[model samples]
Target chain A: MKAIVNVGLKQGVLDDQGKATHHALDTLGFKEIVKNVRIGKQIIIELNSSNEEEARTEVTKMCEKLLANTVIEDYNIEIVG
Target chain B: MKAIVNVGLKQGVLDDQGKATHHALDTLGFKEIVKNVRIGKQIIIELNSSNEEEARTEVTKMCEKLLANTVIEDYNIEIVG
Candidate 1:
């Protein structure tokens, strides 16, 4: 199975990179339609586990232990065959 | 509409960050199940336009110009209400 994880800052946290990107977008003529912008991390893991549940559990553990800084970030894991 | 963009390195490109993370995962005891790991960026944009087609077009243009390094990366854009 494969696990795809998206890690993003919490709602109240200041996203410096996102803010910079938004400003750049505005300057590049997207100011009209671009209301806001937020950026995050996308992690893709190829796992030997075939079971979806097993993959999800392992990936979640990985996130808690290594992939994310839980104090300021939130992560969602999606497992696929 | 909202645009969710996932930008990832092209298959042949060497991802240093991903390699570092993979090494960390192995050291943290995920060596058995963790076959491979890759990392990318996820950019979420809130758009003033409600039209899905328009949002996608605009987001795609943004990707082509600023959001992605076309020579080494690939980006996928999904428009949602």
Candidate 2:
């Protein structure tokens, strides 16, 4: 089975990388096209879980323990088997 | 309008970040649970495009010109507004 974990900064958190990229887009003349930009991380995991529920549980644990900093980030898990 | 640009390493390309994270997971005793792990980036853009097609075109151009490294990364766009 395969799973995708999408992690992003919590709303209202300052994202320096996103700010820099947004500025870059403006410098590149895409200012009028893009209003805002936020950057995040996606983690794709191929696992040996027996079922979707098992995968989701294990992946969620992983996220809570290691994959994300819960204080500043939020994560969503998508199972794609 | 809002759009999401998911950018990931092309298959067969070396992903040091992914490899490192995989190793970390193994160290964290998730080796049996996770077979493989690949890391990627997600860029969320809020824009003022007139329509979905327009948003798609502009976002694709942004990916090709700035958001992604086409030679080593592949990106998918999802408009959400």
Candidate 3:
């Protein structure tokens, strides 16, 4: 099974990278085109799980334990066969 | 409008970060659980575009020009109202 995780900063959390990117875009003539930008990370994991349920459970645990900083980040997990 | 872009290393490219994470997971007792892991970036842009089509076009250009390294990265863009 394959698990895709999208991890992002929680709402209201300050994102320095995003801010820098936003500024860069504006300087590069994308100011009027873009209002805001936020950046995050995506992790794709291939596992030897038997089913989607097992994959989801294990991947979620992985996120909780190591993949994400839950204190200021939010993650969504999607499992695929 | 909102545009979401997922940028990942091209197939066959060596991803040092992914390899490090994979090794870390194994050392953390997730060896049998995960077979492979790849990491990428997710960029979300909120734009003042009129519709999804316009948003998609501009965001695609952004990805091609500044958001991703075309030589070694592949990017997927999705637009949302």
Candidate 4:
């Protein structure tokens, strides 16, 4: 199975990288890019799970254990066959 | 409208941050995280477009101009009203 984990900075969190990117974007003329600019991480993993439920369980554990920093980031996992 | 831009390393491209993350995952015991590890960026933009097609066009422009590094990343945009 294939799983995609999206880990991103929480709302209201300070994101220096995102700020830099926002500045760059503004300089390039996308001036309407309002308030928040938070960056996130995407992790694509291939696992050998036998089924979707199994894959979900394993991927959830993966996110909770290592794919995400629970304190400052939130993550969503999408399991694809 | 709101649009999400997902930008990620192209297949076969070197991803140093992803490598470091994979190493960290391994050290933390997710040994099953086999093979390639690629990282990507997600840009969620909120716009005042009146419709989906307009949002898509504007967001595509955003992606082409600054949200993605066309040389190394591939992006998908999803527009949500």
Candidate 5:
């Protein structure tokens, strides 16, 4: 089984990295087409467990304990075959 | 329009961050269920253009020119409504 975890900042939180990237894009002549940019982390994990439910549960726990700072970020976990 | 770009290290490239995270997960008692981990970046962009084709084209340029380190990284762009 495999798990994909996407962790991103919540609304209202300032994203410094995103701001920098957006500024860079504007400087590169994309100012006319770009409105805003936000960045996050994508974690892909291969799990030993074959059960989808078990993999999702374990990945969620991992997110809470180590993968994310729950106060500032939100994460979504997807379990795949 | 919105674009979701996932940038990840190509196969065979060493991902130090993922390795560190995997190590931490093992230390936290996930050794039995966690097989491997790979980490990447997800960049979400809001575009001034509403057309999906136009948004995708501009965003792809952004990825190629600024968002992704094309030599070692691979990126996928998804245009969302």
Candidate 6:
């Protein structure tokens, strides 16, 4: 089995990387861009759990423990094959 | 309009972060994990283009120019209303 975890900063949080990209875009001729830009991280893990339920449980634990900075970020997981 | 850009190292590329996370997961009591792990980035951008087509074109350009490291990373974008 496999799990995909996406971790991202919450809305209203500052995203310096995103802001820099937005500025660069405008400089590069994209003038109609807006202000809210946020960046996140995705993690794809291939595991060998016995079942999807166990896999989801373990993956959820991983997300809470090591995959996400829960203080400022939120994470979601998708189980694939 | 908005676009989500997901940037990831191409398949078979070395992903140190993923490897580290895998090791950590195993150490943290997840014993049935496999070997291949990949880490990626997600960038969400909000723009004010006149239409979806224009937004897509501009967003694609941005992905090519600055959002993704074209040499090592592949990026895909999704527009969210």
- Contacts from the true interface found in each model, as a fraction, amount to 1.00, 0.96, 0.94, 0.47, 1.00, 0.90
Which CAPRI tier for candidate 4?
A: medium
Runs with alpha carbons beyond 4 Å of true place in candidate 5:
none
**Could you give candidate 1's per-residue lDDT for residues B1-81 as a string of tens digits?**
889999999998999999999999999989999988999999999999988888888999999999999999999998887
Best by DockQ: 1
The value of fnat for model 1 is 1.00
CAPRI-style docking class of model 1 based on DockQ? high
Tell me the deviation in Å of residue B58 in model 6. 1.2
Give the lowest summed-lDDT range of ten residues in model 3 chain B: B49-58
lDDT of 2 at B58: 87
Cand. 6 Cα-lDDT: 0.82
The local distance difference test score of model 3 is 0.91
Q: Every model's DockQ, to 2 decimals?
A: 0.98, 0.92, 0.91, 0.53, 0.96, 0.76
Which of candidates 2 and 3 reaches a greater lDDT?
Answer: 2
Better of 4 and 5 by lDDT: 5
DockQ-wise, the better of 1 and 2 is: 1
Candidate 5 TM-score, C-alpha based = 0.98
Least well predicted 10-residue stretch by lDDT in candidate 3 chain A: A49-58
Q: Model 1 over residues A1-81: C-alpha lDDT tens digits?
A: 889999999999999999999999999999999988999999999999989988888899999999999999999999987
Compared with the true structure, all predictions reach lDDT values of: 0.95, 0.94, 0.91, 0.77, 0.95, 0.82
Query: Model 6 over residues B1-80: C-alpha lDDT tens digits?
Result: 77888999987778899888778887887756655678999988888765888788878988887888888889888887
Evaluate residue B49 in candidate 1 and report its C-alpha lDDT on the 0 to 100 scale.
97
For TM-score, candidate 1 versus 3, the one ahead is 1
Question: Candidate 1, after superposition: displacement of residue B4 in Å?
Answer: 0.5
lDDT of 5 by residue, B15-78 (tens): 9999999999999999999999999999999988978988888888998999999999999999
- Itemize residue pairs with steric clashes in candidate 4: none
Error of model 3, residue B71, in angstroms: 0.9
Candidate 6, pairs of clashing residues: none
Better of 2 and 6 by TM-score: 2
- Prediction 5 global C-alpha lDDT: 0.95
